[model samples]
Target chain A: MYELIKNLGTWLTSGSSWTGTDGIAHRLAEHLQYSLLATLVAAAIGLPIGLLIGHTGKGAFIAINLASFGRALPTVGLVVLVFLAGGLSMLPVYVALVALAVPAIVTNTYAGMTAVDPDVKDAARGQGMRGHQVLFQVELPLALPLIMTGLRLALIQVVATATIAAYVSFGGLGRYVFDGLAQRDLVQVLGGAVLVAVIAVTLDLALSGLQRFLFRHRTA
Target chain B: MTIDWSWIGDHTDDLTTLTVSHLQAALSAVFFGVLISLPLAVVAHRIRPLRGFLLGVSNILFTIPSIAIFVLLLPISGLTRTTTVIGLTVYTLVVLLRNTVEGLDSVPAKTKEAAKAMGTRPLRTLLTVEFPLALPVIMAGVRIATVMSISLVSVATYIGDGGLGQLFTDGFQRDFPTPVIAGVVLTILLAVVADAALVALQYVLTPWKRRRA
Candidate 1:
């Protein structure tokens, strides 16, 4: 255990310098930025579609099947597909990550909307609330918790998968892991693993906090 | 290059063989995962402190990238079926263990108390009462783990394990769209069919859900 700790420490500090072309910190930051941008793009598109489909309740099966297909599509495969289609660099990575995030966001959004208490919706409608007004005023607020849950799940997945973008020489933290493996450096490999684990746990905790905050606000 | 359906049609046998291999890897991983996680979950549930530690470890494991895990394990397991199965099994623990604990915990306290009042042994009570009640949630976790393993197994192709990922890698290497598209389509189909089968199994195992369905 002590040896393990020492190795981990050495790896984390060894990669501290960013003077080289492929600095771990620089790669991490770039990967994170790409992941965040991709997730935001996915949420922007997914949330609206989720809301529209969820509101109409007409295409639930199709929406769900599409999302399931999205989830099943491997990130690496998608990245390869995008690359084959003349998309390389960060664009393919972004597209793949967005594709991955969409299903969760869409599913959760639809579920959250549909799960809104029927009585509250009916009461809002009875009180001269237009369809749009009820959705905006009541449904969206109530569904915020679930929607946030979906966002949280999507965020973690995006961050974890962004490492795969390194395979295309896009220079993400996955470079550390893959390159380390190629070079047979356990220290470097462990460092990359530690960085990813930290990001995932931190994001998860932060999102849990956000979920709690949304739930509390909804009740209050 | 123009798409060639004829070439793919001729290679349907190859596709079927690859699908079989993929299913073998996923099932082996899920089988071992459930075997290990169930007992550990039961033991952890009985001991509160151990439960927290187990859950923490599993949660940490959950965050590790599947490819990274495979890469790390390959040196020790030597690019064999053992590496892929072990890596995927570890991944399943993060999902299965949590669900098992949650499922058991969700069993109503009153049900357990009544069983004890009838002089049922602790083990017997757990098997007879708690296990049945928790079957649905446990099955749900198993379903998720199965799907996850299937998807992650594609990455195992990097370590010389052949599956649908072979198609993807081969396609990429040769710049052939047919194999890549075929691999993607097959993977999606596998996931959907597996998901549907699990849903059916869940229905069979938990008859109460049938009413809801």
Candidate 2:
């Protein structure tokens, strides 16, 4: 344990490791790029459909089934499949990340929207509100917490899964991990692992804080 | 740019071998995951104070990306099936443990009281009344775990013991699309089949709920 920590400390503190194109900054940026792009795309696709289904109470069965099936689809398997079809490209990585993130967002959005108090929505409609007005003004505000939860979950999953891009010879924090593994550099491997864990934890904490804030704001 | 579907046909034997082993590994993980989680979940439920900590640990475990789990386990178990299985099992623990605790918790309050009033011991009540009631929920968790483990088992190839994941790594290494597509297909197929069977099992187990509905 001491050895692992010492090595990790050394790898982390080394001046050369923190700068330039091959450094931690660049890789972290790459990691964020994949995760954020996937998240945005998934939100674009999942949020509206989830909103419609939750609002109109239509096509939920198919949406639920598709989301569940999405849960079953393996991230690494999809990454590999796309990587093969596309051949050592960023396209597969982004596609895999998007596929991996979509289900959580869709499911959570639908659940959140459906969970909103119908009487509250009814009041909004009773106040001369249109369909879109009731949805955005009432349902959307109420569903924000769960929707955020879904986005948080999806983002965390994407960030973690993005590490696999290194496995496929793509550039990211995973390069530190996969390359370190290949070279038998335990320090580098653990360092990379710790960094990825840090990213996940940081994002989780931030999202949780956001959700809590939303909850407070909603209740107040 | 093409799948070379013929290549898949040509490698039927290899594909079958990978699929079966993948299923075995994932199933073994789920088995061990349930075994470990059942007691821990029960303990957490009964203890009350420990509930938060147990769930927190499991959540943290779940959050640690799958690759990191396998790699972290490598020092202890090395690049072996033991590591891969342990990694997969740990991943399933959070899902199953949370499900188990929630399932038991969801058992009706009156049902417990009835069992107790009937002179049933705590353990007996748990066994006879609470557990049966919780089966549907717990089984759903198991279904989730099974499919998730199947999905995650693809990353276990780094430990050199993964089933279909080996095909993916091999395909990527060889720059061939056939094995990659085959592996993805087989993994998804196993997940769907296992999930469908579990859903069926849940339906069979919850006949009372169905009748009420």
Flag clash pairs in model 1. Answer: none
Instruction: State which docking tier applies to candidate 2.
Output: medium
What's model 2's lDDT at B89? 96
TM-score of each: 0.87, 0.95
Report clashes for each candidate as comma-separated counts.
0, 0
**Per-model DockQ against the true two-chain complex:** 0.50, 0.67
Question: Residue B6 deviation, candidate 2, in Å?
Answer: 3.7
What local lDDT score does residue B115 receive in model 1, on the 0 to 100 scale?
97
Q: In model 2, what is the error at residue B75, expressed in angstroms?
A: 0.3
| lDDT for residue B46 in candidate 2, whole number 0-100 | 91
DockQ winner among the candidates? 2
Best TM-score goes to which candidate? 2
**Model 2 over residues A34-116: C-alpha lDDT tens digits?**
88988999899989988999999999898888776887787777787787776767888888888888888888999999999
